[model samples]
Target: MTAQLANVAAVHADEPSMPGIVPATLARIKVELLGFIRNPQSLVFTVSLPLLLMLIFGSVFSGPVEGTDVDFRQVFISGIIAAGAMSTAFSGLTISVVIEREHGIIRRMASSPMPKSAYFIGKVLMVLITTVLEVALLLLVAVLLFQLDLPATAALWGTFIWVLLLGTAACTMAGFAYCALIPNAKSAAAVTTPPFMILQFISGVFYPFHMLPGWMQTIASVFPLAPMTRGFRHVFLPDTFKAVEAGGVWNLQGIVVTLVAWIILGTFLTAITFKWRGPRVR
Candidate 1:
């Protein structure tokens, strides 16, 4: 026993140290992202649906933003971008996690040596990738088919990045936390879609905010999706489009604060409530 112990200790001493968390997590993120891309339904939901929606809405709607020379198609571009982000980050992520848990993937992963942080890092990276693709495709369609003006100034692009980051973080974390409330994969859409679908109209994804009743506007403003969409509009739309927004202009600072708060609170709730395994079968 002593000889075996000594040999094990010598081997351990000679072995190289493992890679750091950041590198490992990044590698895992790539793997996870590839898995997402391989899934055809994920691609359809995340990328194709939003693009189709943009095309349909942009085709049906026309005219300047109440007073601006910028076409209404440009406004639809921003709204669809926000919709894509929310679809991928919140609805997609939540359902993915719940389904994985239902199938024992999360339980297997929990038993492995992989760091828990890597799982979330992978998820967030996937959201970022999918969201960027959705936005790029939407912008391409806007420029090619609609002749919409893309943001030219560095400041405008910077605002785009800021809004994207905040929206992604808020939606991803909230999705993670919300997944804990799901009972099974079968009920995923039942729990996920109502809010997302309802938010589409109230949050101005399909209609102008000013068209909704005052109470509806108030209710929508409190949600992350509404504020995130409005924030993107602030970046992409001409300033004159602000006349149609509920408050006469997007509250850029307020949107950031609300998204940040959701990130913090969602992270806390997810850490405590997320399940690594499906419920015990009684």
Candidate 2:
């Protein structure tokens, strides 16, 4: 008994200390990024599809918005950028988590020595990085092809960064929570895509917010995408274009509040619902 105890103590002394949360998260981020790079089809769907939509819509609606000097293409570009971010964060994350759970990868990871929070942090960070890339690509195209204007002031630029981060975080957390509803990988798209599509349409991505029916506009206001779209527009569109916004003003406070609320709710839901194993697992 004494020899066995001594041997166990020696083995414990030889084992390296586990990394801190930040380091573990960063390492996990690297792994997630490498996995994403290897999956070219994810890039095609997550990035390419949005770019295609931007080109089609931007070209189709090249004229100025009705009653405002702001170009419709500019509005479309900002709206699509917001929608694309949500797509990468919410839809993409949900599908990925569902598939991982279904494949037993999540279960294996849960049993691993790595910090459990690292897995979720890595997933959300991966989505944020992809979202940034998507937004940059979309903005580059908008600037080159549609002549969309960049944010004029440092303050506007600051707004852009915060809005992007907060919106992405809210969507990421929501994705984690929503994935619990998915029964398996096969139904991921069926469960996630329709609501995303509907949000885009109602949240002023496909049409101007002011133009949507009052009921639809009110419904869209309850979701993160509408406020996110409006926030993006505040950065890109001219002040005069505020006339076209839901309240005829740039309600920055409302946008921030809505996003923060969603983030809180999503975090709570994720804590309760998230499971390492698939729903069918015993």
Candidate 3:
């Protein structure tokens, strides 16, 4: 009995204690979030672009978007929300990382004993934090500054939040994908941003999906941001709102499909392409 007990104790001791997922991830995230928050450029992206869009569309285009009867406030707000989430995830981090790689941050980190997973997890956690903050900030401004109304259904807010989280995750994966595939850090801003900005504009972030031209709408509908924004609008907007034209047929389903497909594709690409080190930077 004593020998058996001793063996059991040894085995129990050898076993990993609860895997430490939450605590370790939280600690790593705290560090990353601290760095991210302090970064001037990161703060600007996570806050500025969304604010700019909100002010531009909210103030200038107060009337209906070209393609739909949806009020600019109703249709455009959700898209800006989605855009804010995207800006936080990919724009801030990706460009910064490219500079980091050019500056030898990646090489130095590689030389150290840091785990690649830790770096990834940290960035992911940081993205999550920023996304949440960005959403809150935008919403606060939308409410207090723009006097935007609360959602019609309470459940819609929850759905909106979920879509935002997933959208942010998709963008983070996108950022990782870029870091791995884009050869040099020097050109990171030049190449990655145009597609992202276009994705936002064409995908209905600044306007209603119905406003997009036929080909552009087709492309945007299948992509991530438009679907997310449309879904988000569905949850919050009123039943009387004409923006629900694509509800069962195109709106909600499109959101789910786009998010799932992009998430899978982005994650796969992110995994295969990501690298911590490379040729010496000039």
Score every model by TM-score.
Answer: 0.90, 0.94, 0.83
Error of 1 at 97 (Å): 0.6
Cα lDDT of model 2 by residue, 1-282, tens digit:
999999999999888666788998999899889988888988789888889999999877777777787778888888999999999999988998899898888898787777899998898889989899999999999899988899999999999999999999999999999998888999999999999999999998999888889999999998999999999999999888898776689999999999999999999999999989986654
lDDT of each: 0.84, 0.90, 0.73
In candidate 1, position 172 carries an lDDT of 94
lDDT by residue (tens digit), candidate 1, 8-33: 99999887656567876898788778
Candidate 3, residue 126: how far the Cα is off, in Å: 0.5
- Worst lDDT run of 10 residues, candidate 1, spans 64-73
Residue 148 of candidate 3: its Cα lDDT? Answer: 69
Candidate 3 clash pair list: 67-211
Error of 1 at 132 (Å): 0.7
Q: Please give the range of 10 consecutive residues that has the lowest summed lDDT in model 2.
A: 58-67
Candidate 3 structure lDDT = 0.73
Model 1: runs farther than 4 Å from truth?
A: 1-19, 65-70, 280-282
Clashes of each: 0, 0, 1
Q: What CA RMSD would you report for each candidate?
A: 2.8, 1.9, 5.1
lDDT (tens digit, per residue) of candidate 3 on 170-262: 778778787875677777778778878999879877656665678897887776677777766776555556443543343555566678778
Q: Model 1 scores what on Cα lDDT?
A: 0.84
